[model samples]
Target: MNAPAASSHLLPAVAPRPVPQVLLDALSARFGPKQYSVAQAVREQHGRDESSFDVPPPVAVVFAESTEDVADAVRLAAAHAVPVIPFGSGSSLEGHLLAVQGGISLDVSRMNRLLRLDADDLTVTVQPGLTRKQLNEQIKDSGLFFPIDPGADASLGGMVATRASGTNAVRYGTMRENVLALEVVTASGETLRTGTRARKSSAGYDLTRLIVGSEGTLAVVTEVTLRLYPLPEAVSAAVCSFPSIEAAVRTTIQTIQMGVPIARCELIDVNTVRMVNRHSNLTLPESPMLLMEFHGSPTGVAEQAGTVQEIAADHGGKGFEWATTPEERTRLWTARHNAYFAAVQSRPGCRAVATDTCVPISRLADCLLDSVQEADASGIPYFLVGHVGDGNFHFGYLIDPNSAEERATAEALSDALVARALALEGTCTGEHGIGLHKMGFLVDEAGAGGVEMMRTLKRALDPLNILNPGKIFVL
Candidate 1:
């Protein structure tokens, strides 16, 4: 959907609430003292995320080792009318982990088990705590792999909660497309199963999709069934340098328009290239560049690379670097994945306020170039990178976290970029789900009617508002 202009600012400050002693005692009794913690440090650690939004930590943290544990935590939270926030790897760029309403953090990281792996069916069922990397490692011998990579080794549960997509999304699609089924715990602690192992289903309301991107506001996902892909017969990686951001983006648009089955097409601006060079210990040319990957038979990969090389040359692209060996391929993509940290370390002690705007493929050039120009004009230390094949990109604006003026400047630039993207019929956030930071923008993206309908569903499923309250929308 084309997101409307972002209208909301930062989340309104919420006062902290005390956890009822009786509820805490009950929790301790139910799950032993070791499974639950109310220590100050633990609560503080669970309260923040990779984002800048700050809120007090949950009054307690419960380590859930099984689906029944999750259900029980939710049931207890509901009984006390307290909020329940699900915790994963804590790598979320938005404040999806913040305990805004003061409740218990039901951490599922302990439930990291690969329950079922059906190689013939190309499907796998896993408990919520397993990270994508771990899952890939365990399944590597099966000749299959999970393709949705959000750069960070994020947990599957967290990825589902945010509806994450990564560099591979140009070909593999996002979590919204890849997740086959879900086991979720409702606000009232009911275990609800959505979808089946079958590839297609007209079973009912697509509750799987509904809970996939709910940001843990609707239900806490306990288990996930994922679609897997066979390891490609042949893989090739390439890097092409362009004269300018516009040229690189134009090349991307034309490649997609020509229906090239490029697996990964990423745009790294000159500044980001410089950062990656320093961070990754590779001396790549400092210019706007596109790093890409192709998967197929040897002949197919060669044909695809030749086609993209011609397209790149037409746009004045230089230096078509290819990685032939497995080690080379890993090094190349690892550098690309570390772009975020590279951008962060570029400015010592500066926190990054990033933008996530995606425009239609046709308008990608205009939208990207305009946003880059704005970031340049702001004089904020920033880095740019994009999944250009899909018309999605990001700008990491580095600023002093303590300086309110700098923070506001970065936010203003982000807001302006979102406004421009919306005007171009794009979305305010393409991959990063709306947590605390983009709650206001949700209204613009989803009209009053759409949001009200969502509210109606939330009320129907969670009458007590116990699941991740004050997240996607105010209740």
Candidate 2:
């Protein structure tokens, strides 16, 4: 399995990056008559996402409306040696949606629909296209909620595919813990469903997990069955201010060390505070803060809240603003969710370059210090935030996209961060899956034997190399 050669059709001319007619024909054959149009608008719309890079636009974009459509599209792609790129809400930050290899961009947006909500069982089945916000909207009156909130109202399928985690992951866990089943269309146009509704399974080979984080490389997720929860009896949040980054990190480490069960524990540096204040349109004082949340029976939440307050006090922390009202809690998370954009927005016209690294809980303090040091040494204007409870942090570098040197400097810092995480015996990626952006570093992190096994699985599943070609490996 070798990487596909760069398409010669991508000549730098007036009609640059010509779409392959063979792929267009395949789409028409698989999709039946006049439903799919070969219009330029479709191709332009599916070109790229929020990533800080550029690439060729997909040759065509098929609006997949059902699992059958996804399977057919994959078959068409396989037959023509065309790469298949699955797309959801186009919210990916890592170029996961970019058509690096020219092919049909399978847009799953049209498939958005809620199929089931078994409240008594505390589970839900949904089409991959339904956004998180959309799902909650449909189930708001049902007294059940999906807790894997990845900030953006990103598609549930997209979130699961990326193995995303956000503000609530500290208490609720990532998509890895919330997702129960998946209906997938494999590389060869074969459709299969994995995972049962059972609370837990010791079943053979954990296929559900394999597809959950595959990033559409192994399969296109058309449907997802998720583990839901009874709406918590009570939810409350407070923001605690710290004088220094070390103080903030120390508070976080100690809180987790004490096992406080805080549902959302995050570290926002003073630098990010300025950005949040401006971008959130609020006048929060410029300082390092630990934003937190608790979920349980009212009395239990209260006890957990008191435990956290005591722990933070020992670490020189202050600024306790309890967001007890629903509106207050919404406002708090809204600020946190927009942290990425806030960092980018601070520097007008600049792009946010983010790198994710997760270290062992015991090594979090050292990892934080090293990240700040390396980032400072590189002299990139950056903001730091994290799911500190899980020792996963993100360093977002703001760069002027037009300046090549500045971009290179940011990329160098990013590479250093991944190396540092690997050196600390942690993963280069914790939540965000190893999409194309992390593939090269994943090899370094995964080592030779690990990558070889990955290649073996790639060959076993996608022998033609038609599904997301050149991803996760050079081979």
Candidate 3:
């Protein structure tokens, strides 16, 4: 069967750039037969991500074990002007890993290592391939932990590339704030360092911020130095169910406005609560729910919870359950993190077209309620979840991949939702970067002139246009 037509937000079909045999031979010689793979399985694995797009896989996969390995592989790809798509844990949702202009998939999962740790400064430097869970596990005993959790146990490199934020972002901020430094492999195969371990700098260019959310278009991040946080003395997790999403959202807005330092405030609508209940084996109240966490001294946490409980009470929130034990807290959060998978499993053989939009705290209710009404009217099976404390949320519209009609309907819903977000002075994407899925929305969010400015930077850094080509606005 012919593939479904590209959505208005997706890149049109493009021929994959030819990968010359010499480049493959060179890579094989350098990395050996085991490390360099032309096998279909490896290429297929590296070629796609959680996105709905079905673009062809890259020509080959090159496993890089070190920064030297990444630099060498990139240099070889540069020599032939071949697109080099960096592969992390393969959890990105925006088709970021697709090889639209086929070349090589540079797998950095083997480069996983903790390079440096400075508990005194609350900073640590790690290789790009190290996952967030692994990093936290390694540093758990140090009294310091990295708090940027983007749903997936994503690689630090991938998290840095996408400027990801998650449940903890309501207080700790996203990668843009936490990522202090980077060692990047430039398009020309040269290694370059940006930022420093210092908390703040008045240095030139601020290349660290530039590369943090560049989506691998500017360069491949080899190492990331991140700001860490000390584990809180007392931590508490709680869930409160509301009669409606509006009630839950209003409570959240009030909490944030009243200056409550909520570590995580996530919203799971009734449908998603049911899915999570089934998937995670929990008997959560099947209603619009807020999963929240508080971090501080025991008294401080109690005070914060009491204030929020009163606010929730005003909004008709009830069944405020607390999971104070570590195991219970883990189970609740694990279910929250597994929401996407739970949703996916709820509908077998379906592809999800997820929408990520964030509005101002005051405008969230307006933006979200209208979108919810439209989604309910559309008759698509979906799950609603959000880091609502910061005005960001996602709706995963599950559709049968084989049905062109379903794909078009899902795209229409996403497009209208994005237009609504932009109209409310919000971004089309809060965390998921502009990969193949949101090219048009990028132009809508950042005007043509702004996009051109991005293209200018892309050209200057990657003149050959070989680094993750056809992403973050066509260059």
Q: Count the backbone clashes (under 3 Å) in each candidate.
A: 0, 0, 0
lDDT of 1 by residue, 85-160 (tens): 9999998887889888889999999999999999999999999899999999999999999999888999999999
Q: Flag regions of model 3 displaced more than 4 Å.
A: 1-7
As for lDDT, the candidate ahead, 1 or 2, is 1
Question: Model 2, 271-386: lDDT tens per residue?
Answer: 88888888878777688888899999999999999988887888788878899889998787665788888888788899877778889988888888877887777777899988
* Residue lDDT tens for model 3, 1-475: 1222323555667789989999999999999987999998888998789999898899989999988999999999999999999999999999999999999999999989999999999999999999999999999999989998889999999999999998899999999999999999999999999999999999889999999999999999999999999999999999999999999999999999999999999999999989999998888889999999999999999999999999999999999989888998998886689899999999999989987989999999999998898889888899999999999999999999999888877888888888888889999899998888888878877889999999999999999999999988776
Better by TM-score, candidate 2 or 1? 1
* lDDT for residue 415 in candidate 2, whole number 0-100: 72
Q: How much is the lDDT of residue 202 in candidate 2?
A: 93
Which candidate would rank higher by lDDT, 2 or 3? 3
Show pairs that collide, candidate 2: none
Worst 10 residues of 2 by lDDT: 1-10
lDDT of each: 0.89, 0.80, 0.92
Ranking by TM-score: 3, 1, 2
TM-score of 3: 0.98
Please report, as a residue range, the 10-residue window in candidate 1 with the lowest summed lDDT. Answer: 1-10
